[model samples]
Target: MKLRVFNIIKNTKVEGPGNRYCIWVQGCSRHCRGCQAVHTWSHKGGELYDVEVILDDIFNQKDKIEGVTFLGGEPFEQAEALGIIAQKVKEKGLSVLCFTGGKLEELRENQINKKLLDNTDLLIDGKFIEKLTDYSRPWCGSSNQRYHFLTDRYNEEIFTKYKNKVEVNISKNGQIFMNGMGNFDEILRKVDLMGIK
Candidate 1:
């Protein structure tokens, strides 16, 4: 199966617990307000890669990364393909953390999400509400967003163990990419003022 992908970071610390291989899948129907990844909202916008290719990349970094993260364009949008990758990674003792704009209740109703949900170690749900924005928690930016510890791999301890942070990745194309939770625009503004670009 093929998955539309916006970008993939082979290893990153701020996205989830420890070092993680993060996949930002392409296409989000829910255009949540103040979404940082507006570029990923188009269905036809990103490159497509075979599921096997993504899985191979994850495995290649297995020894270095603690797990893999599926964030998007809503991850649930490409649930089936991600489910396959999620399950395979779990078998290798790699944890899975997924982010979604949809509620877990609604997602559970769809049979397509079973494997992905079942294997997910941590699932962050709820759309980002700009007005309710609060970065007190890890990863998520809104007070409304909730974290579900789907498995024992992670839990309430994350509140103390991790903090919201961002990583600046200068991609192979020389594009400045930022990931994680924070005031992205302000950060970019500072970067611009610094004459870094």
Candidate 2:
């Protein structure tokens, strides 16, 4: 199968745990306002590439990367192609992560999307809300999104246990700042009082 993708980053530290290979697939419809990757929202925006070819490149980096991340253009839209890549990544014993605007409930209704979900180890889901931007949320652009650890392991749980929010800020001057959930003093206080840590 062939998939349209905007770009491929061989190594990324922010998208997921450790270092990850991030694939930005092409096409999206839920054009959220203030989307960071606005260039990726159009359906006809990216280059076409064969799934096997992309897999070959990923395999080349298997030695150094911890896992692979599937970002949009709504990865669920390319479910068929992603399922193929996810299968190979599983064979390598590498963790799999996905970012999507579609809710997990809706994804479960489609067989193809379900396959993509089955192969994913971690999922960050829901549309990005600009008004909800908090520099202290983990792996999500907005506070309304969620991170699910689909697999048996507790990696994401541990991550959230330490800090549930992941904050990121980028300035026009090209400066970047990222902090974990604990940095939000009010949230930390709630977590402590509620014994939710």
Clash number for every model? 0, 5
TM-score for all models, in order of appearance = 0.97, 0.79
lDDT of 1 by residue, 56-88 (tens): 989999999999999999999999999999999
Candidate maximizing lDDT: 1
Overlapping backbone residue pairs in candidate 2 total: 5
lDDT of 1: 0.94
Best by TM-score: 1
Residues 41-71, model 2: lDDT tens digits? 8888899999899889999999899899999
